[model samples]
Target: MKKQFFYIVLMGLVAPLASCNDFLDMEPMSEITPEDYYQTVDQVEEFTNQLYADILTTHGSYSSTFEIDKDTDNQPSTETPGNKYDNTGQWKVSMDNSSWSWTNIRNVNYGIEVITENYENGTITGDETSLKQYLGELHFLRAYAYFSMLQKWGDLPILTQAFNDDEATLVEASKRSPRNEVARFILKDLDLAAKYMTPDFETSHTRISQDCAYLMKSRVALFEGSWLTNFKDTPFVPNGNGWPGTAKDYNKDYQFPAGGIDQEAQFFFQEAVKSAELVAEKYKNSLTRNTGITPQSVSDVNDYFYMFGDDDMSTYPDVLLWREYNKGLGITNHLEVIVQGGYDVTRSMVDCFLMEDGRPVYNSSIPYDDQTIAKARSNRDPRLVAFMKQPGQINYFINEDYPADHARKDEAFPPLDVGDGTVNRSLTGYRIRKGGSFDKARCDQWNSYTGSIVFRATEALLNYIEAEYMLTRNIQAGHILEYWKLIREAAGFTGAAADPQTTNTYTSIDKEKADWGAYTAGKLLTDVTLYNIRRERRCELMAEGLRWMDLIRWRALDQMCKTPYHVEGFRLWDVMQNEYDLEPADYDGGNDAFVTPPSRGQYIIAYENIQEKSNLYRDGLHWMMAHYLEPLPIKQFLLTSSDHADVELSPLYQNPYWPLVADSPAEQ
Candidate 1:
């Protein structure tokens, strides 16, 4: 079924390129010449679809490892020597690696240029509505590409057009714009895209729609606003101390396009609220619910579970955009298989989930050391049960090839036991079950066709709440309380039903105190409302590739460096190890094997432990403020240096605290 759909879309995409052979095969200089092509709206739409296939596909979304969520505070990876971002001291400047490339920007700008020029000249002889819609998609793609660049490299060279191959023109275009100015430019494109985009939702949820644009606007605005607010005193943000961005001589005293930084933040935050409100109001019913265990619904326990693992998300109205994978089309990923205990879930994440009674897990009567798996998970948020692989839970059924000896039977999984000397086991005993399909046939396969969600209305709701809370700093605001109620109700909070009036009981003040990421360590969050809001986001969006970005925008990593914070796993040595055979002969003696003479009470520790058993970070996790923004490649400076003979300094400035080296060891 998905194959047919892929072929249908592929045919639509291929037809335009096939028809415009002459235009496509034109000289490199005249390849994007508007007069040559851009004749029909169908062709324009087809061209825009290429952008979706190229830039927005799931293939482009994933990093080298499918598990991008690993190595964070919430999720720990199996491999030692934690992710480069976590290793602050070892990080160094590279000569070639950077996000300054313009390949995608050129593609998007070329499409926009062709559409704008052709539409203005009255050359596009097709349905104006279709042309406008495609134009909207191009603008959205351009904004998305620019935002991606802005996130990696603070300031960027804002280019709305394809540049010629002339060296002089290329050199002039390399000037970096202010981060705030770049953000405003992205918002400008989003506004245009939203203006021209079709108002109706796309049933496929794969294409860029008005809602997607609005969602992205909210995301971009909130990211910039939060970055400015959190790191206002640092050089990472615009108008901050040691900021290197300079306006051209003509605009020496260039004012912020929005206003002063504070006012600018408010403007963006308001925009976030406005756009997110539109999505929440429009798709309020699309939110997935955790309808409690019913006789008829017993087969599919949680709607939220299948929302991530299902082959199709067309039924979920909240999903604004998703990438559909088809095995027959040779477009599939192993995410479904990987989520099943492949990437380890950390204890920190497990503790984040609120109790079923809307209280923190720590606030329960059971002591920390005495809490069993069942005790820890008991009366917790339904999402925890739905998303995590609990002890002794039946995950899937295994069918026997020979029926004479055996019949198909359900596989009862054991508790999170990592020191078991198994390769596929979780590094941290806790494992992720969020994206795993319950069906054995699907879960067992390598490349399952389960769709990946790109944008969902749940994110918009969270965005609106956070943006509003940030702007007003009033958690008990009428609208804020209402949205919180909606989210908790949909999530199947136990207290949600009784608390119709939306009282503060559901907001556990005690739970806020127990939150590890809050107030303690380096985090300065003091307000319970603010802490709870962040907690909601952390719980709802766990292992969704959003944690890293959240930490960056919130500037939360500084807290990790303040203390000897350890990335701890389950109580493997203390209790979980007993679940497996302890004999020395049972071990494989591989690098992933349990430490010899396994030390008691020492789970996977971030820093070196006295037992020398499970230490991934021997040197300890140290974070430098300079790591907040990646350094520009030194090769860029060298190239610019060649343009001038007498200058000892390069034309561009390196990111603050990042020493510019002429050359360095190539990235492995």
Candidate 2:
């Protein structure tokens, strides 16, 4: 079943589990009962197969983890891209969260109940290991669904068993559990998954494995721990000050599992460290290495350069799981064009990288010029060089007999002075090369078969480093130190041994203000050590579809409450503007402009170049307390609002500063 990843199994699963309309899609499915259907290991495999494809499918609408991760600080686009992050007013109370409903969880829960009972009661029979692996896959998928829900809406109902449509039963299950409890529940499921699943299940790299379970658990725990620690005494936490949950009877005095916020945070951080270290240890010998070669040096091969682009990701053991698309099967994606032109990797993100001498770029004596793309990437972490695309670098570094693909021009910097359909242009001058390929077959539109990495072991080490620091305040010691070195070395640093202390000591907020990593929850971090720990994670996982989660948990936008943060790209005015057809003054068209004004700053301001007068982020991107957690749509409350005039008694509470009124913005 895992080998069937590249094909059309996703659309053809007869289980009606796509989004179970009722508790378990109670509509007839060939008139098969749980007992009758759960007769073989093959049935179990079919039941849970689509979950792998559907659960984490499209990490974002971009269809690639390495994307122009807009909305967050890392990748900002013009036309007020996802204005919710810029102005709270852009966020109206959703009418319904029906799209992210419990249907997926219910489907997974139904599978769990049936499979466990059938296996235990002899209703199903198969090779013991195979059956357990299938069951474990179900558990893993359920945890993944709940974890995603936790990020969107903090407190989620920890549903373990499938329920009937009894009105009282359904409503009771709708009660949102405290986020920490949900995190713990997710961890428990992951443990069950790991216990039954082995590393590289069925010796296939595409399937859910024990190591993948560990990596995911670490990520989930790190998120909860960080959220708890940062939003400690705020209304965001379960029993924090002015919490909306406290107004409800069920959560009036919500006692945390570890007695209090601080202890509970520590508990989660410990879980993160423990689980992360397990995978970190497992993959200590197998992490990918950077060969210090860019895509331009196609003649001289670099394993790191080709890892993401390679369709056969199975060769890369560090990649725990990747979605393999087959060109023969007519299943492919247009990733090369996106990465070739690149995601709008923020100017601040580029500045965040440290010098090769184990020192902050601001303080290091290394020539720190950022006017050109070459200057910005020079003398910095090798991860920057390996990933950032430059102009004149050939897109077709491999087979070029295809004249159509060969005729494609070398990457050109996009006209920042313009707006509207930026098909294959770099919004920020800095283009991404991480998941890019030069292979002729993958170069064409919608014909790319570059495997999308689902989980990488590098993140487990990163999770361990940050969670340990958050818990113990000691990074660069013991396994933390070892993991830090491993990441730095793999990133092609090729310099002094990895030292977080030296880097932290030199990381000045005033000198490096472009980097929002130094700030947490609107306040500038005085704890430079903690800042550096976060810096490592930021560098390692850039453009990997994890920035939003990291920012939300860090409460990184809190400072935006006091001052809006204008997201900027490379210095277009100083050097690159001459390369384009337009100039600063020429960008004066009220609506038809394609470039940002140079008068604003040296760098290209992403949101300021928009044509729309209604653009909320024309000035700068702002934030709200409620923006961290999505507003629980009104329809959810209305569903249980019956019999309880006060909606608070309806088993759900509006998040933080958001009101119950439909279409209302965050009150804060």
lDDT of 1 by residue, 65-97 (tens): 236666677776655544454443456787666
Best by TM-score: 2
Using all chains and alpha carbons, the TM-scores for the candidates as numbered come to 0.84, 0.92
RMSD of candidate 2 to true structure, Å: 5.0
The per-residue C-alpha lDDT of model 1 at residue 255 equals: 69
Model 2: CA > 4 A from native: 1-31, 58-62, 403-409, 417-423, 583-585, 610-612, 644-649
Cα-based lDDT at residue 46, candidate 2:
77
Model 1: residues >4 Å from true position, as ranges? 1-36, 57-66, 81-88, 246-254, 292-298, 365-372, 397-423, 443-446, 496-521, 583-603, 606-616, 642-649, 663-668
Cα error of candidate 1 at position 154, Å: 1.0
What is the Cα-based lDDT of residue 235 in candidate 2?
88
